[model samples]
Target chain A: MANQDFVGIPSQVDTRALNRGASDFQRLRRGLLFNYLILGAGAILMIVPFIWMISTSFKPQAETVSFPPRLFPINPTISNYIDVFDRANMGRLYWNTTFISVIKTVFNIYTSALLGYIFGKFVFRGRDVIFYILLSTWIIPFEVYLIPLYLMTVQVGLANTYTALIVPEIFTIYAMFMFRQFMYTIPTELIDAARIDGAGEWYIFHRIIIPLSKAALFTLIAFYFMWNWNDFLWPLVVIADQDKYVITVGLATFVGEYWSQYGVIMAGASLAIIPILALFIAVQRFIIEGVVLTGLKG
Target chain B: MIQTIAQKFTGRRSTLRAAEHRFIVIALVPTIIFYAIVKFYPIFFSFFISMHEWSLFGNVSPYVGFDNYALLAKDSLFYKVMWNTMYRTFAGTFLGAFCSLIVALILNPIKRGSILLRLIYFLPVMTSVIASATIWKWMLQTRFGLLNQLLSYVGIQPVAWLQSTTWAMPSIIVMGIWGGIGFTVIIYLAGLKGIPKDYYEAAEIDGASSIQLALKITLPLLKPVVSFVLITGVIGGFSGGFQAIYMMTGGGPLDSTRVLALHIYDYAFQRMFMGQASSMSFVLFAIVLILTLVQFKLQRVDWEL
Candidate 1:
């Protein structure tokens, strides 16, 4: 009967140790609550200005400049939206930005994808040499090359044209690197299978590679579109004519024309940001993966 | 007869390899040509132009072989701008990264409302610098600004934020941090998310306090992300600060904000000293390269996470 009996281990008899652990847990939990409240307040502080911008965009000019400012527009009007398109020539700027974005996206994706495909899948002579040069280009800041690029654009009759704006960015090494890393994940057997079926490299890339690489491509598209849309420097340098001005340049002009119209500037910014925001939201899932993947690779 | 047929087929196979090379060339041609014409050729041409004292007028630009660079060495503005750029980069990068990490760490411990916080933090990053600059410009206005209005509440006099030489650069730094914190937060958030919950649980079970847990586990695990942010923060802050200075201040208020970027812009665009600008750019480029290398060296080993 004694042999049949069982008792808890000696460690379990240490009730004071158990009490201390519970007390510590309670303290930590309380501390966490205070931390969370403070953090939330900080977050709200960070967000208020952005909300203010959107709110100001809705209000009338007088209301926008009101003492202490309003959190929400009292009488929100569509006038700023209308003004963005009608008075500010935002429509023209949209076209310019869209044109640049579309061209740059297509060119960047295709060129980078192609170069990445070759570099990733193929083993050819001078591959390492070429890749080394490409890597070297990553560290070379665009500021170093800006004046030269502008001079070259002017020399080549590309100045004052969209070509000048889009052409230089087509050789996006980051995109190439991204695609190369993604392409490495794809099994060689898939390619080999296609090759056995008498498929050419072009057919293989178009039919096989493109279809399989949707996630990365979308990430690239979203990223590049945002970049091209928001770019100020290159467009400022090359696109001299008003007609060639992208949104950033056009917004600068808007400021010059309506220097006092802060509401209108906000309106223009809202308009400019909407498409990129939409794109980011659309590809939100993939973007996180792409970003994390890129970080790890780095 | 079989040997002869095999020989003929081998000749055709060699021809097919040749054709493959041709196809590869064709596929690569457009990118190569565009890259050379658009990117590389311009870089080379800039080097050529850097040798000449070019003017906007029809005056012949005589070759000035390194004279522009030599002039830069003696130019007080050049040294001053370089100094300003370094200062801005150091201050902005370190402070920005530090603030971002703090925000990230604080948010990481809170399970609820983190997503909303992230979006809030990311808004400034998504907004245009020009647009944000305008709003901040209004808020920081000397006489009638909200910041001064708030200062009045604290019994302080209205101070010039952007107009004064003493305050101009600091104003830019304040704006730079405001504009920069969001992306930095996002980067840190992403970094924080990667830390496993088990690490914290283990620390808790071992009777380690929150501060000790953070120091031992979180900070060590987040080093790589920290390093990345630090290096990129420097680069982004330096370049972006220069940009804001150029666009917003025009490097004005006695050129207190005349960082190298604005200096380069003025030389290249306003003064039409393309060669001098190019030399300045190269000098800045060298500085950036050195700074980046130094950062990488300092943090390479610490990038355990």
Candidate 2:
């Protein structure tokens, strides 16, 4: 009966099934090719504006306002770049941004990791409660804190100073949470072994924990550097001195002052992007990991 | 003798526990204190000042309970800005997430040059808001703009993009999508990567069509990721929409692009209405809190998986 039942499934059925499968495979392959074509076109759309910016930056002022805009400059010139550097004080903006970003990144990584280690490893009274309270602070937007924070900074006489620019940003709640999540994956045995060897808590943290979590540290560095480098609002609010202004605020002010100077503005914008773009391209993986890790966990 | 020994052992353990507690406190106090000073104190202070009549550079302001709140209630621009904010949040989040999902789906099957495409898409995100918005603003110029020029090639008349109030918000929304889609793509890509391949293979063997496979298998499986992207997109749109608007529109062509954050900023800094701005800030905070709670409820479902 089993043999008869098997035979009842016709050879024609097998052949038809095979043909359908073959056609389905062909359709899928065709669909994938079509998708690639669409995605290729989308990629061009994504990249053209940047190309346009660079092109405009290189164009002569006359050509920037020409009737039929050119994708590439008709008469490319370095005058815009020269003017931005010489007149707009690009060098000062670069220095201020780099200095503040570096200082903020370093402190952010250290404090975030230290607090993360404590939260992940320690058992103390009110640990969960304190951590939850800190986490809830993430919901409060910077606008909510803008008034009092500004007032506090002003009262302390740190307004318009690099100290104001770099201090408040260093202690971020998100980075602390990220580092804590990263630290949770680290085994307790490693710390225990260090402690057994007479290592103090600070020694174990500085040596074993920090070294083991280099990936997370690097991730936070890239994240923090980009954030601080691109921060506009806080710096705009606090820093009144043009010499102290970060690249973002300086560029914004440049835009306002030179609204019609398209070529110079584009040039300034291009230069401002180069440092962070280089950083991003170099550490793209870490940035992606940091973002993904936070997305999944948060 | 036994009692003495037990006492000594217990005493030593208690001291060790005390030392551990000390270490914990020492390691954690600075961060907790800093956070309290920077974050918590300002939040409370903001609330306190919201109830007062304050001004920029003023040391003391008379307390007027609910007066600022009352002024906000009567301010018609406040309602308009709220509407603008909600519109941008909903429209931008939807368009951004949808476009990113499509891109992710397309790029998922392409083994070649996927990373390169991702890099290209993510470039705008890496660029500063000022730079990107500068380029966008120039492109959205009514005449001789790149966008208009491109439209002309299709035999379409040039439309005033940022200059017209009707088109201004949409223009910002479009740029918002462009700059934001990369983040959504990357997140969705990560989500796509998490979907197991064997399921697809099994479905193929069963003669499940590609669209069916996507609808039945992929969509259902990616629900958690979709929710994450949507919720975060909305949250980000509410809080951070100010930068782009500030750069591109400066809250007009008629305040069409004025969002809550920009409104608060204008009240506090530009207009020097600190008390009114603080009240508005609390309202924004309340909205964010409600949204965040909703996200938590949704995320709990994701966590169960």
Highest DockQ: give the candidate number: 2
lDDT of 2 by residue, B1-305 (tens): 56544654665546545666777878678777888899889998999989999897657799999999999899999999999999999999899889999998887776556667888887887787888898898888777678888888888899998878899999999998898777678677667767877898899999998789889999999999898888877876777677788888898988888999899999999999899999999998888888888988878733112
Off by over 4 Å in 1: A1-32, A285-298, B1-23, B109-112, B193-199, B295-305
Worst 10 residues of 1 chain A by lDDT: A1-10
Top candidate by TM-score:
2
Clashing pairs in 2: none
Q: Can you tell me the CAPRI class of model 1?
A: incorrect
Worst 10 residues of 2 chain A by lDDT: A1-10
* lDDT by residue (tens digit), candidate 1, B34-114: 666755676677777778887555668889999988898899988888778877878877888888788878766554445
Clashing residue pairs, backbone N/CA/C < 3 A, model 1: none
Q: For every candidate, what is the interface RMSD in angstroms?
A: 14.8, 13.5
Question: Model 2 captures what fraction of native contacts?
Answer: 0.62
Candidate 2's displacement at residue A119, Å, is 1.1
* Per-candidate interface DockQ score: 0.20, 0.30
